[model samples]
Target: MLYLWIKAFHIVFIAAWFAGLFYLPRILVNLAEVPPDSVAERARLIGMAQRLLRFATVLAIPALGLGAWLWLGIGIGKGPGNGWLHAKLALVLLVIGYHHGCGVLLRKFVQGLPTHSPRWYRCFNEVSVLLFAAIVVLVVVKPF
Candidate 1:
């Protein structure tokens, strides 16, 4: 019962975190397209990006904590023959790095210095989608 509860909340946090991850870059895509003279619109988009980045980061902590609890305390993926678990952990690391990368991009936008094109951002936005899809597959299918 405890394991089930932890797993449930972990899923919740992961979903919320991924939601932030999915949306923030879309906002960046808009930011990139904003005309240089459109001050109000750019400010509004930057504010939105700021809030979403903070929200996603907050959710990531508990998601990662609960995941650690499930792995270390509840032992969901301990011991030998757990290569699938290892792969999932690696993917998680990548996603975490990506999350921080979003913050970096947001900072660049705040400075009026986005280095990537809107098309580049569109491609970057899909990265989380791919990572999340792989994560779901690993968790559900557990095929090593």
Candidate 2:
């Protein structure tokens, strides 16, 4: 029962996290092209993007925690020996790193660190999208 409940929660959170991951980069794609003259609109765009990131984090952390429990606590004691699981963990770590990078950028933005530069943000967006897509593939396909 506990395992089932945890799995449900994990699935819900993972779904939300992946949705944000998929849309964030696309948002950045438009943000990169938005003109500076539209200050209010730009702020709205940035705000929405930041909120999505925050939402993703809130969902992902718990999901990953539950997943860890399902793996290490409920599942077998296997480590990195299983190629599919190993690849999944690697991709998960990459996603976590990407999440942390977003957090760093969030802090910088909050601190008024001149975050309007679309170049760096766009680059980060590209990296985030790639890493997230890779993680999704690893999870779905479990390819070695």
Candidate 3:
């Protein structure tokens, strides 16, 4: 029963996290297009991205904790070679890194400085999307 609940949380959080990951790049692109002089509009977009990010973190952190518990705490870590588990954990860490990178970029944006070019932001977005997709595939297929 507890495992089922944890799985549910994991699914919901993964969905939310991916949605934010996909949308944040577009937000950054839109912000870049806005005139520099339009301080108010730029600030609005930045704030929106930040808030959405806050929600993503809220979902991700606990969902991760619950997943770990569902695995380690309940002894679900008995798979062959533990290959599937290791891959999933590595991807989860990558996702966490991406999450933190987004926070750093958001902080830079809040400073009103264009630290990342439009192309860089786009690449960041694509990488995050691909990593996330890979995670989903690993989880579903469990290809050892």
* CA-lDDT, candidates in order: 0.94, 0.73, 0.81
Query: Could you give candidate 1's per-residue lDDT for residues 28-61 as a string of tens digits?
Result: 9999999999999999999999999999999999
- Residue lDDT tens for model 2, 88-144: 787788888877766666555445465546676667777766766776676667665
CA shift at 51, candidate 3, in angstroms? 0.7
Instruction: Give the TM-score of each candidate.
Output: 0.97, 0.73, 0.90
What RMSD does model 1 have? 0.8
Error of 2 at 94 (Å): 0.7
Q: Name the runs in model 3 displaced over 4 angstroms.
A: none
lDDT of 3: 0.81
Question: Which regions of candidate 2 deviate over 4 angstroms?
Answer: 76-81, 104-144
Model 3 per-residue lDDT tens digits across residues 1-144: 878877888788778877887787777767767787998999899989999889888878777887888788886658676588788888888888888888888887888776767777778778777987788788788788
Best candidate (score: TM-score): 1
| Candidate 3: RMSD to truth | 1.6
